[model samples]
Target: MSILPELERRFRRALAPVEEDPDPLLAMIRRSQDPKFGDYQANFAMALGKKLGRDPRQLAAEVAGRLSVDGFCQPPEVAGPGFINLRVRDDWIVDQLTAAIGDERLGVPAAAEPKTYVVDFSAPNVAKPMHVGHIRSTSIGDALARTLRFAGHRVVTDNHIGDWGTQFGMIIYGYRNFCDGEAYGQNPVGELSRLYQLVRRLIDYHAGKTRLAPLAEKLAGLESRLAEMHAEAAAEGKTGDKRVKKAIHRQQKDIDEAREELGELRAKLEAVEQDPELSKLAAEHPRIGQSVLGETSRLHAGDEENRRLWREFLPPCLAALGATYKRLGVAFDHTLGESFYHQRLRPIVEELIAAGIARESDGAVGIFFEGQDAPMLIRKKDGAFLYATTDLATLRYRVEAWQPDAILYVVDFRQSLHFENLFAAARRMGYERLELKHVSFGTVLGEDGRPFKTREGDAVGLESLLDEAVARARKIVEENDDAKPGGAELSPSQRARIAETVGIAALKYADLSQNRDSDYVFSYDKMLAMNGNTATYMQYAYARVRSIFAKGGVDAEALRASRPPIFLNTPAERDLALELLRFGEAVDYCLKDYRPNQLTSYLFELANCYSTFFENCPVLKAETPELRQSRLVLCDLTARTIQKGLGLLGIDVVEKM
Candidate 1:
């Protein structure tokens, strides 16, 4: 029933003895760009003509004459520049839809040669809360995993939690020295964030002191120079002297900017030193980073007290993260932390050394690539292992434990070089047979084209962001309900559930509908709209389809059981049928590129086609019973396709939105 494969079959039969290789003209067959041309176009004749030094149009004519697609499609026509166009007959379109109507998978075929995939994504630090930065990787990775699973691939989802790291050191130190026990008992993450911030502020204060003193001195000198210039200009009647006045004005502006910066820097430093505990520690030790690192080193060495503190800090942080993931409907097959691979780091480094892939560079084990400046460090000079070392161990463990065919790391685009070295190192470690890929994504920018954040300029927390989205969506839904008939009658529970569904869908679809490699500005107002490519648009489209069935009193189950013949009478009806039938093709195309946007684009186009059909061809008031039944079937199929497509993106469609 898939058009591409059937056309390929006809093409293979047409050019059986013409070419020596079977797939020589393979990518030439594709959907037509213009509707004036037929449904599918084959540009094989042009390439074949180039090979044989024959006229392309003449070759196309011969190929068109020999094409054997009579019943499925009308006569094949050779167009300009050796493009052969083919259009399917209406009868064949209905036959395909009838056959596809009974299948749960909607006529999409599963992979004939399925491969196993281990997708690693949504990696949040153990005690650090999830924020807006985590959305792209988590949402995109989950969608790709679902697509692959639905396509019959064995997928293992892993959330590589950052449990053992320098951040934990800061937390342990802050809790012991500066924590408010009552505050932490009530809001663990909030109190923990405050503690972490205090430690970080202390570090920044000491580090910025040297720069701040110089800046303050420079600002004072600039202000003194500006005052002298202004006095000289005023004494010289500089109001009429444009050059002198301009110079004085510029000097004053520069002085003002410098003063502002110096003031802010000093204020921040003073605030950090205002904390009594940190001030006392600053006076006593003068260097807190070293102490934090000492605690980190002990934790690495398995200190009992640090371990207990870490255990205490992890639960509340995880609960906060779990709440966010639950709202987004994201789950993981494995939740392995970096601490799980701590025991294997040394052995991994030793194996690399024995295999001649790793060498000691200033007491640190490193892997160097030819023509590269820096060697990726596996072991630090102080006998500490880095993330590179743990990544290597994780790769080996995944391969040996699961024997996966492919492993995808959904990480930030900033770590391109890190993944490059990691993959190269994994290959050197004898994983050449495995397919390793780093699916890097860009940052979510705000309306101002910077990283998304609150109006207060703080990074948006993931849960807070979702909660805001739901609240905003609920207000819109309520507004709609009040403005329309029977909308005010919706109970509070129903409105609440609908708002949650719409809001989460809006957030997820807004992220998924964009090209993954490009930086997209996140705008809640634009993404949650009832029109365009937003999730609300698609949701409303599905609801409209359902409403059609309801108004017509059409029994979808009986219709499916009866297997009625679908007759495409008008241009809109045929276009809709074509779009619906290409659902399988769209899924295949999306799976191949690992781009959910492709599927989104397909569903959006399908919705557009449905809209056109609804406007032009009346379903309940059709000219004949056959036409009405056919349009009803089309509506049902389109709704099902939208539901299945959105579900793959981990989005839900409401029945009565």
Candidate 2:
């Protein structure tokens, strides 16, 4: 229903008589970069002429003559170098606007062929508090699901939580050794989180202590090697030689990295040693790492006490996760945790072995690839099932139960090899027809260009992050509301409500606006700014449009009922209308590559176009009543488009931000 796709469809029909497969040629048609050229342009004639051995300009003229785009565009003009420029008709734009005004979905039509999709994302370990690392997966996955469904796809969002993992083992070990019963009774999840952290800290302390000697030796050897390289370079006067310089540079980098590693290990060890209580605990539990693993094995093996403890601990952990999801406005169609597939893990491994897809590798079961040095391990030598095993079981269950056309894993890029092997193994096990994709993303870095962390080097908690964003947003909201021309118009409760919406929208939009594969530095000031591509700007744009109707005492529904004729009297009006009508095209581009930033870019452009229109064209103050009604319709349409686009990105707009 968008202009480009409709143009492409017509081009496909016109090119059918000249070429057998016109898809490659049709792809050359795109929106013209400059308005002076036209609304859309096609540059396929040169390629087509090359293929058919004809003059490109002559071929373009012939193709343009044969094109049937009546009422949609002007007659195609064969420009220089066999380019075809087609400008849409003004009446066509008016007709589209009129139809969109009365339609709930605007002018965006349902997909002709929709497919079922299963989106797997946000698989945080429920035993620990959700942290900043989980934000990208949760936000990206939710936005993709919303956009795909709006684009007329059957989307199933599954939060495959990590319920049965080693983290739980650490929690169990900590509870047995260090739990405060009164604290647990008061706040089970909080106590469990504390215990998990305590056990993990002790394990890290011991591990660092054990690795301190080897790391120091490695650092010393690296420093010695670097000195030798420098001395050789200076003595031989080979410093100017590119190879010697490169070797020295590489050697220095290695030495620096080694020294940094050694320093971090020493710092961790010192922290534990300085804390009297922690030092005592570390001495008492020197083998915490192995002991935690033993507890995990017992739980997995159905030991009665560990099993009972797991059952008791799961509910509070789940409740905590649910509250966070609620705050973020994210929901999943199905939450199938790792424990759900435990019973089937063994059977899946046995089936893989029977099918010859897997074999014994050093007393462990794994799937080997032709060139891969390391096989995909499904079970350890000690008969403990691994994550890969559970993943295989989950894949089989989804295929059998949902019969989806595709399953997308929204995870970080570090697991690229794991997904590569998982997909390869799945194909070997007869899942060749299904679409398996790994939507990998990069890290969230702090201003220091490293992974975001607290002063203690711990991950920033998700709840605390939300709290800070809201607190900052509340301050902004109160200032703006109090500075209104007529005085403060919002009550405390209303101010609080608006602050929450803006704060959450700012957070979600900040992540959604970036290219999902690139690492982005987090900054509150930039994300919450009143201008640029921030959600605050878009929300303000929407509010500005709504204010036009409110001030005029106009009923938007009644105006739409009147169905006033849309007029593109000025360049600004026409540009705004064109951008408004291309909402469906933006959604299509977004789903084409599973990238939400595409939608964000489109919304930002639409906002800019509307701003231009507002500056140049008046709505309620138009010259005539009919013109006034038409402009009002444009304002309403702009507000609706902005709202719908932001909604698709899992953001809300304030009516008076």
Model 1 residue 109 distance off true place after TM-score fit, in angstroms: 0.5
Return the TM-score for candidate 1, rounded to 2 decimals: 0.89
Candidate 1 — which pairs collide? none
Candidate 1 lDDT trough over 10 residues, lowest sum = 481-490
Compose the digit string of candidate 2's lDDT tens values, residues 76-145.
9998989999999989999999899889899999888999999999989999899989999999999989
Please provide the root mean square deviation of candidate 1 (C-alpha atoms, Å): 5.9
Candidate topping lDDT = 2
lDDT of 2 at 349: 90
Best by TM-score: 2
Off by over 4 Å in 1: 22-24, 210-286, 454-457, 485-489
Kindly list the per-residue Cα lDDT of model 1 for residues 528-614, writing each as its tens digit: 775798888888889888887877888899988888788876899999999988987888888776788998999899999988988
State TM-scores per candidate.
Answer: 0.89, 0.97
lDDT of each: 0.86, 0.91
Question: Which residue pairs clash within candidate 2?
Answer: none
